[model samples]
Target: MQDLTKEPRLSKKQYLVVASMLFGLFFGAGNLIFPLHLGQIAGHNWLPAALGFLVTAVVLPLLSVLAISAVHAEGVYDVGRPLGRWFALLFMVLIHFTIGPLFGTPRTATVSFTTGVAPLLPKSWETGGLLLFSALFFLAAFLLSYKERKITSAVGKVLNPVFLVLLFFLFFVAYSHALGNPNAQAATTAYRNGGMSFFNGFLQGYNTMDALAGLAFGVTVVTAVRGLGLKREGSVAKVTAKAGVMATGAIGVVYLFLIVLGSMSVSHFKPSAEGGTAFNQVVTYYFGTAGHALLATLLTVTCLTTAVGLVAAFAQDFHKHFPVLSYVQWLALMAFASFLTANFGLETIIAWSTPMLMFLYPFCMVLILLSVTAHWFGRDPVVYTLTVGFTTIPAVLDMVASFPAVVSQSSVGVALTHFRDSFLPFASLGMGWVVPAVVGLVLGLGFHFASQRRQAGAATSNDVQPDNAD
Candidate 1:
C-alpha cells in the first residue's frame, strides 16, 4: 500500500480551493432552501431559530470532519468500529442508503428539477419533465464522477466559485432593498417563542440531511487533502481541520444571508410548500425576468454538483465494501436509482424520508459528538457502546411517534407511541433521545473509571507485597 503520509504539501492557494470544494459539496439541495423557510416562519424569532439551526446544520457537520480527523480513519465505519464490526457495517450501510438512493441522491435531482427546471415547463409536463430532467442530471453527475479523481479541482476551481458569485449577488440584491417588514410573526406553535426555537431548529436541521451526508463526505475531503500531497497523518488532519473550518464559515455565511431573506419576507410573502417557490418569488420581486434565468442556472449547477459528490461518495464506499462490484458499476446503479426515485418529486421524497431521518439523525448526532470528543475518555470502546446503544431506545421511540400516519395507526404502534410520548422527557418535542444520551455518557464514564481504579489497586497490591512470600 502507498504511504499517504509522505504525500507532497499543497500550496495555500491549493488548500483554499479544497476548502471551496468542500463548501460547494455541502452547499447543495436543502442547503439553499431550508433556512429561507425557517426565516420566513421564524420572523421575530429568527435569531434564536437560526442559532439552533446552525448548531446541527453547520456545527455538527464541521465537527464530523474533525471527528474523521480525530480517528484518522479512512471511512465513516472506522468511527463505528468500536461498536463491533457487524454493527459498524450495518450503520455504514444505512447512512450510505440515506445519503444515497433512498434520500439524498434522489433529492439532488428532484430539487434541481423543481427549483431550476420545473418553472420553465408547463404544469401539464411536470411528471415527464422531471423524468427527462433527472435522466440528464444523473447522467451528467455519473459522467463527472467517472473521473472522480479530478472532483476537487473540477468543483473547487470551477463550480464552487460560480455558485458563490451567484449566491452573493442574490444576497447583495436582497440586502439592497428589503422586500417586506423586518418585523413579522413571532413563530409557529412548534416554536412558540425564542427559547423553544432552539430545539425546533435543531430538529429541523435534520431535514438538511448534511450531518449524515457530511460523514460520508469526510472521505472525499480527506482524499482531496491527500491528493494535495500532504503525506503525514497529522499534516492531513491539520489541513482537513482548517478546510473544515473554512467550509463551515462559508456555509454559515450562506445560511445567515438566506435565513435573513426568509425572515424579512414573512411580512409580505407566505412560504410556499416548497421553499424553492418562495425563493423564486423573492428573486423575481427584485430582479424581475432576469432573476428567473439566474435562479434556474444557479439551482441546476448547485444540485448537479451535489449529486456528483453523493454519487461519487456512495460508489467509492460501496466498491470498497463490495469489491465484486466495480466503481463504475456502483455509480451506474446509484445513478439509475436516483433517476427513478427523483420522478416521485420533491414533496413526496421529503414525506417518505422525514420519518427515516427522525430515526437516524439522533444516532448520527451521538456518533459525531462521541467521535470528535473521544480523547476526553481515552477513546474507550465501552463509552462508545454505552452512549450509542442507550441513544437507540429513545431514537426508536421517536421513530414510532413520528412515523407517518400510515404506520402509526396500527394498534401496537399506537400503544407504543403513546408510551414513549407519555413517559420520555422531551418526547413531546421530538427530542426524547437527548436525556437518555447524556445518562448513557455518564454511566459509561462511571464504569470506565471504576474499572481503571480496580486495575490500579490490583497492581498496587502486587507491587507492595508478594514476590518473596510466593
Candidate 2:
C-alpha cells in the first residue's frame, strides 16, 4: 500500500482546476444577501464594510485554500491533525452538520419558502406549503445526486453560468434604476465605529463558512479531478488553483455588487430587514412582481442544489473514514437528518450559527496558519498543539460570551461567561482570540527553537574528542 503520509505532487494547472471546484462549492446565494444588508447599513461606509466583509469572504476563504494546499491535506480531517485524530473526526462531523441540516439546509428551506413558495401561497397556507415544498425539493436533490459526480458537476457547470446571468440581470437592473432615481438618502452609520467597518465585514463574512468548508471540500475537488484523469498531484493542484481563483473571483464580484445594491437601497428602503429580506425588497423595487418571482426561483434552486451537494459530500467523506458504513446508508442518513433541520427557516439557522462559528473558526484558522508554517515549525506536533490550544481557549470563551442565552443556564456556560467577562478578548467583538493566538504561535515557536539549539549543543559536547583528552 502506498504510504498515505508521502507527499503528492499536484501540478499547478490541476491545482487551479481543484481551486475552481472548491470555489464553486463555497459560493451560494445565502452568501450574497448579508453584505448587501451591511451596505445598506454602512451606506457611505460601504467601502470599509466591504473591506471587512472581504476579509472573511475573500481573504479568509483564500487562506483556507492556501492552508489545505500547504499541507497537501486529503481532507478537512487531515488539516485538523494538530488537534488529534478524534478531534479531527469531531471537527469534520460538526462542520458537515453545521453546513448541512442544522444550519444551511434549514436556511435553504426558509429562504425558499419566504421568497419563492410564500409569494404564491396565501398567508394561511404558507407554513404547510413550506414544509411540503422543502420535502419535495430535497427529494429531488437526492434523486439527482444518484446520477454521480460527473452529472452533478455538469449540472453545476450549467447552473453556474445561468446563475451568473440571472445575477447579472439582478445587479444591472438595480444599479440602473437606483442611479436614475432623482433622490436617494445615504445609509445611517455608514462611516462610524472608528473604522470598525472592515472588522465587522470580516465577521459577517465568517457566516459564509466557505473558507472553513473549503478545507473539507478540497478532498471532493481532488477526487473529482482525479476522476477526470489528471492523476499527477502537481497537475491536480494547478488546475484546482486556477478553477478556485476564477470561481472566487466571480463570487467576490457578485458579493461587492450586491453590497453596492444594498447601499443604494438604503435611500429608499427600511433598514430593519436582514439579508434575505433586503434582497427581496431590492428585487421588488427594481423589477416588481416578476422580478421577485425570478429571484425567488433562482435562490430556491440554488439552495436546493447546495443542500444536496453538501449532504452528498458529507456522506462520501463519512464512508471513506468508516469503511464499514456503506455509502448508500450514509447518504440516506444525511438526507433524512437534513430534511428534519430544513424546517427551521433561514433566520433561525443564521441566529444559531454564530456561536458555533465562534467556537470553531479559530481552530480552523490556526490549522491553516500552522500548516502553512509547518516547515518553519519543524512539523512538530507539540508546536501545533500549543498554538491551537492557546488560540482556541479565547475563541471558546468568546463563543460563550456571544451566546449568553444558551450558556447562561449551563454550568459550563456560566463558568465560561464568568471567566470570559474578565478577559479583554471576550469583551471585544467575538474576535478576542486573534491577537492572542498569534502571540501564542510566536512564543511557542521561540521556545521550540531555543530548546532545539540547546539539544544540539549538548549533543556536540558529548561527541567532542576533547572529552577523551581531558
Candidate 3:
C-alpha cells in the first residue's frame, strides 16, 4: 500500500484538472434541473430568485468545502469530532445516510429517468420503465465507483464535457430562439413575489442539498488532491481551496445560465409540476425529438457521474468509520439501497427524504459556521457542543413539521407543531434554530473565556507559591 502518511504534490495543470472534477461532481443532478424550475416559477422575478438560490446552493456548499479544508480534517465526520465522539459519529452517519442511499444516490437515477428518459417513453411504460432505467443506472455507477481508484478520471475527463457541451448547446438555443417572452408567466406563490423572492429562492435552493453533500465530499476532494501529490497539510488546504474556487466558479456560471434559460422558457412553456418536467418541456420545444434524446443523454451522464462520486465517497467513509464492512461491501450496500429507493419513483423519494433533510441541515449549517469561526471562540469544544446541541430540538421540530399531514396532525405531530409555532422564533420561516444557536454560541464563548481566566489566575498563584518552594 502507498504510504498514506507521505506527502504528495501536483502541477498547475493537474490542479485545474482536479478542480474541474470537483465541479463535475457538484454540478450534476439538482445543478441541472432546479434553477430551471425556479426560473419558470419566478418569471420576471427570476433574477432575485436566482440570487437567493445561489446563496444557499452555491455559497453554502463552497463555504462547507473551505471550512472542512480549513480545519485540515479528513471529512465531515472529523469536523464533528471536537464536539463529542458520539455526536461526531451520529452527525457523520446522518449526513452520509441522508446524502447517500436515502436521497442523493436514488435521486440521481430517478432524476435521470424523469429528465432524460421519461419524456420519450410511452405513458403506459412509466412504472416499469423507471424500474428498468434505475437498475441499469445504479449498476453502471456502482461498477465504475467500485473499481476506479482515480475517481476523478471518469467523471472529470469523459463525462463532464459530454454533459456540458449539451448544456451549452441548450443555453445557446434557450437564449437565441426567443421560444417565449421571459416575462410571460406571473411569479407564483412559491416565488413569494418581488421583495420576498430572494428568500423564497434561498429556501428553494436548499433542495440542491449540495452544502450537506459538501461535508461528505470533502473526504473525496482532499484524497484526490493528495493523490495528485500535494501532501503537506497546509499545501493540501491551500490547493483544495483553489480547487474549490474553480469548482464553484464553473458551476456558478452554469447555474446562472440555467436560471436564465428557465426564465426565458417561461414565455414558451407552461409551468410543469416538477422541475424535471419543465426541463423536458423546454428541451423538447427547442429541439424536437432530437432534443429529447440530447436531454436524456445529458441527464444520464450527469446523474451517472454524480452517483459514482457519491457512492465512492460513502463507501470510503462507511468502511473507515464502521470497519465490519469492507469498502466493497459498503459500496454494495449503498448500491442496493439506492436501487431499491429509486424504484419507488422520484416524488416518493423526495417526499420521504424531506424530513431527514429538515433534521440534518440546521446542524450542518451550525457546524460549518463554527468550524470557520472556531479561533474566535478559542476553538473550545464547549462552543461546538452548545451550538449543535441547541440546534437539535428545533431541527427535530422542523423535521416533524414537514411531514405529510397524515402524520403531522397526529398527537406527536400536534405537539411538535405547537412547540415550533408557539415558541420558536421564525420557525415557519425555516430559521427557528438560528437564535438558539447564536445564544448557545455566546454562552459557550462566555464559558470559554471564564475558564481561560481561571486557568490564568491559577497559573499566577502557582508562580508565587508563597515562597514554599524556596
Candidate 4:
C-alpha cells in the first residue's frame, strides 16, 4: 500500500487545471446573468453594488471552499458533522437537493435556452422549444458526468477554456465597439442610495447560489487534489484552498466585467426584465444574426459544464451515504428530475427558487462562518447548535415573506411578515437573520467558555483532594 503519511502535491500545471475545473463548476447560468442584471439596475452606482454582490457571490463562496479545507472535511456531510450525524445527513440532503436536480441543475437548461436559444424561435413555439432543448441538455450533461474520474479533465481542460474564450471574445468586441457610457446611466429607484445599493447587490448575489455550490463542490476539488498524489489530509486541504482562490478570483473578475458590460448596455437599450434578456439584447446588438448562434453555443457550453458538475457531485455524495442506489442510478434519477423541472420554464424556475434561496442562504452563511472559525472554539457542538437554532427562526420567516405574492398576500403570510418586520432587525431589507445570528454566536461562545471554566475548576478540586488525602 502507498504511504499516506508522506506529503504530496500537484505541480503548477495541475493546480491550474484543478482551478479551471472549479471555475467551470461554479460559473454556471446564474453567474452569467446576475451580474449583467445588477449592472443595469445599479447603473452609475454599479461599483458599490458590484462590491456588495462580490461579498456574497465571490467572497462567501470562496470562504465556503476554504472552510471545507480548514476543517479537512471529506464532503458536505463532514462540514456539518460537528452538529451531529442526523443533522449532518439532513444538511447534506438539503444542499444536494437545492444545488442538484431541484433548482441549480434544472436552471442550467432553462437559462441557456431562454437566454441563448428562445429568441431564435417563434413566440408560439417557445414552449415546445424549451421542452426539446432541456431534454437534450440534460442528456448531454448525463453523458459528460457518467465517468466521475474524468470530470476534471473534461470540464477543466476542454469546456471551460472554450467557454472563456467565447465569453472574452464577446467582451473584447463590445469594448472595441464602445457599446455605451456606463458612467452616464442613472441608478434605478432601488439602487439610488449607495448603502442600499450595496445591500441590494449583496442580496442579489444570493441568486447566483455559488456559496451553496461551493459546499457541494468541495468534495470534487478535494478528490481532484488527492488524485494528484496528495495523500496527507493537510496537504489536500492546503492545495484545495489554493485552487479555490484561483478559481473564485477568476470568477470575481468575470462578474465585474459582466456588470460593467450591463451598465454600458443601458446607453443603447432599456433595462431588461432579466439578465438573460439583457445579455441577449447586448449580443444581438453587437453581432447581429450571427450573435444568436454564438450565444446559443456559449450558453449551452457554459451551462453544460455546470450541469455535469452538479449531477456528479449529487450522485457521488448520495451514493456514498445511501448505497441503495448505485452512482449511475442516482445520476439517472437526477437528470430525469431536472429535465422535468426545466420544462417549467426559466421564469417559473427562478420564481420558485427565490424563497428557497432566501431560506437556505442564511443557514449556509452561518454554517460556513462557523466552520471557518471552528478552530477558535474547538468546534464545540454547543456553539454550532445554538447558532443554527437562532438562525432557523429568521430563515423560515424570511422564506415565508419571500414567497410569491400569491402566498405572501395571504392572511397567514401577512401575519408572519408583520411579526418578522416588527421584531427582526433588517427584516425589511431581507436580511432579518443577520442580527440574530450574531447574537447566537455571542451567547454560544459564552456558554462554551463557562462550561470550560467549570470543567477546569472541578479538575483542580479533584487534584487538591488527592493531595489532602495523602
Clashes of each: 7, 42, 5, 0
Task: Kindly provide the TM-score of model 1 when superposed on the true structure, using C-alpha atoms.
Answer: 0.96
**TM-scores of all models?**
0.96, 0.88, 0.95, 0.97
Question: Could you tell me the lDDT of residue 129 within candidate 1?
Answer: 89
lDDT of 1 by residue, 203-265 (tens): 778888888878888777777777776767788888988888998888998898888888788
Task: List the candidate 2 regions with Cα displacement exceeding 4 Å.
Answer: 1-20, 179-191, 404-418, 458-470
In model 2, what is the error at residue 199, expressed in angstroms?
Answer: 1.7
Tell me, by lDDT, which candidate is best: 4
Model 3 — which ten-residue stretch has the worst lDDT? 177-186
Judging by TM-score, tell me the better candidate of 1 and 2.
1
Clashing pairs in 4: none
Q: Estimate candidate 1's alpha-carbon lDDT, on a 0 to 1 scale.
A: 0.84
Stronger candidate by lDDT (3 vs 4)? 4
Which 10 consecutive positions of candidate 2 have the poorest summed lDDT? 179-188
- In angstroms, the error of model 1 at 430 is 1.3
Write down the lDDT of every candidate, Cα atoms only: 0.84, 0.70, 0.83, 0.91
- Give me the overall lDDT of model 4: 0.91
Off by over 4 Å in 1: 1-7, 184-186
Give one digit per residue, the lDDT tens place, for model 2 in 88-120. Answer: 898888877777768765666677677665876
